[model samples]
Target: MTLSSSAERPSRCADAGKLEVSFEFFPPKSPESEVALWTSISRLLPLCPSFVSVTYGAGGTTRERTHQTVARLVRETDVPPAAHLTCVSATREEIDDVARAYWAEGVRHIVALRGDPPAGIGTHYEPHPGGYAYAADLVAGLKKVADFEISVAAYPEGHPENGSVDTDIEVLKRKVDAGATRAITQFFFDNDIYERYVERVRRAGINVPVVPGIAPVHSFKAIAGFAEKAGASVPSWLAQRFEGLENDAATRQLVAAAVAAEQVLDLVDRGVTDFHFYTMNRADLVYAACHMLGLRPKTDEAA
Candidate 1:
């Protein structure tokens, strides 16, 4: 559950297919946060992720900001940008129009999702009338608009609303059938959970790369809160690692780094070559984790 900070960092992954990484960031809410987001983007850019995704706010709240950020990514950066498109509060035409705009702006990848309702109602989710009813439906609609590479979400631990993790896998199968090219799992701490989920995925005949999602703990308490709503479990041991470190930022950071590095390294040891990082719009811990994974800056011929 914990790794010493002094453990050796790998220089590279030698296994077949090697290692591939991608990052996720939410659109900024303010000018200061926007600056922080770009700062993070700069820090991770040199690691050369396959693509970086910008998240859409629930009910499409950050729709314009997501579009603007993605357009900038297309124009300003060398990396491919994947804009999140959700079937939240928009009509089919509206969503399609946004897709077309992204295509015109040189954005070729999309993260399609069936986002929570805009109104933030309780657990009962009813697809908005006249909108795509589910993520599978959304994926199909995105395909019709353009032949963009699509990445859909998978829940290794069942989604809070889903009664069974197996049911979530079935939905993932339909998404792949509808043209999703990849799947990024919900962030998970337990490798066993992810390994078993992948096993089930293969048994269901879904062969797409189901990348494990890694979330570096910026704040354990906050993350624990999110896990509760996300239907993901936070082990008691994790809390023990953070206990009494609330006021100690430096020590807490080291502990957080240790925990996340251990998680990813274990996955690497398990032969998982694909990874998706939920950056939470910050980069320090993520950068460190990638470094341990043998990802180096562009100037580093050592990578």
Candidate 2:
């Protein structure tokens, strides 16, 4: 039977077969957006994700807001929060202080990266005169501050700045050696690309969970624009899927859920279970996708 709307679908309870998920959110820029961010958090928290992360802005632009948001998550939420740290514009002393503060605040996990240059994407990234030069250096430094569980960025398709896949894997190996426990990938639509990258990573003897990053296509045009700048490929097939639907918000949501569900299920069938969603601070599409994956709000029995 055809469903009248997305809400018509019935909710299921958590399943016996386990599939762990995490979500990523960016710190809000305004009071109103802060309200929206928490609403999204409350909506998705019930899924009992492994952990949620708040993103740091380019060049530490949102350092204070990021700290505030992450501190609040530690203080108020049952789910663990991972703070993102970047080495783009800060000195080692400042970065170390941030790490120490997080540890003091009971924040133990961090997504460390060599953040984009302050000038913006595509511009050259210059390390601060006294800061860590790369993510591996930052990871090592964090380890010195505390035994924090660190996660670094990975790319299925090699990073834009890297000259080759081998170079990218070498960089990743350095981070893992430096104390990274996990690597969350840049989102990609093709499972083959991810699988290949994982194979390469494994062959290099860097053993860690490189979790797939999944972005539910909220706005195809917007995501396409981002993918373009971020050096991610937007498949021609994906474009066809969203063709001519830019004006249709309601139908677009439905299509977005379907596409994301299909992507995750296909990955599940291939023996992948853990996933990290770049939630973009919107919950409907992600919640719907999790529902289809047989995840549910924790009930007394499930909890």
Candidate 3:
């Protein structure tokens, strides 16, 4: 699928109205980061996302912290919390216990993942012995414990470990068959990649929503590093746009906003109605993008 030139792009969706946007946040490490994260949450809560998700770190390093954050969201906020569960370094009983605990705490949404290897992204992933083999297995286990709404990860380019696109789609199908309600994609910068990926998934008879995950590039260097490991392509044009702007923080942020807004508007023009943002615990850039898409804070009257 070829992309249109920026000037040749169609008009924005006037009648599209506000999209159903959700955010994914990670568990913060320090007290300061914790405060910052909640502050970001408070800011985005008014946007009334369908739900907010907390990420489980590699090897389940942040399991307790992820639980703490999800539990707090359930206890304190009006938003629904989706806890990320992974099948790395955790036994079946332990993983099931976590799911049961989330159920007891009123969290009904789970993002099941075949987590990165304990050694990290580039390393080979050997599923823990006696543990769930992949996200599909974990999703199946969660369904038995409770009627939970499960979301699993989907890769547009392809999973890092998968042999091909057909294999990736088959893995996704397996997850859905195991009862996942939806599949959220890993972040990709190019809109065409996402559009074509969605088309392919639909053609494969997977009817569930494959929500595009949009990551607002906060730091060019940091995001580039992540993009390398996640199989998300970083276009040379994007690199050129950010070239030599490292010394200019304010200008870099403004450029980031414009780039992300264009990416989303392009998507909306292509008929996307749902979005999942990787907020990285920051609010302003995403807030601006959502505003451009016509999303607004819910007022008391509306509530």
lDDT of 1 at 123: 54
lDDT of 2 by residue, 9-42 (tens): 3222334257899999999989999999999999
Note the Cα lDDT for every prediction shown: 0.90, 0.90, 0.91
What would the TM-scores of all predictions be? 0.93, 0.93, 0.94
What order do you get sorting by TM-score, best first?
A: 3, 1, 2
Error of 2 at 172 (Å): 0.3
Candidate with best TM-score: 3
**Which should have the higher lDDT, number 2 or number 3?**
3
Report the number of backbone clashes for model 1: 0
Off by over 4 Å in 2: 1-17, 120-122, 300-302
- lDDT of candidate model 3 versus the reference: 0.91
Using TM-score as the measure, name the better of candidate 2 and candidate 3. 3
**Worst 10-residue stretch by lDDT in candidate 2?**
7-16
lDDT of 1 by residue, 1-303 (tens): 886443243423344227788999999999999999999999999988999999998889999999999999999988999999999888898999999999999999999999986654655677888989999999999999999999999999987896488899999999999999999999889889999999999999999999999999999989998899788999888999999999999999999999988998888777787789999999999999988887778855654
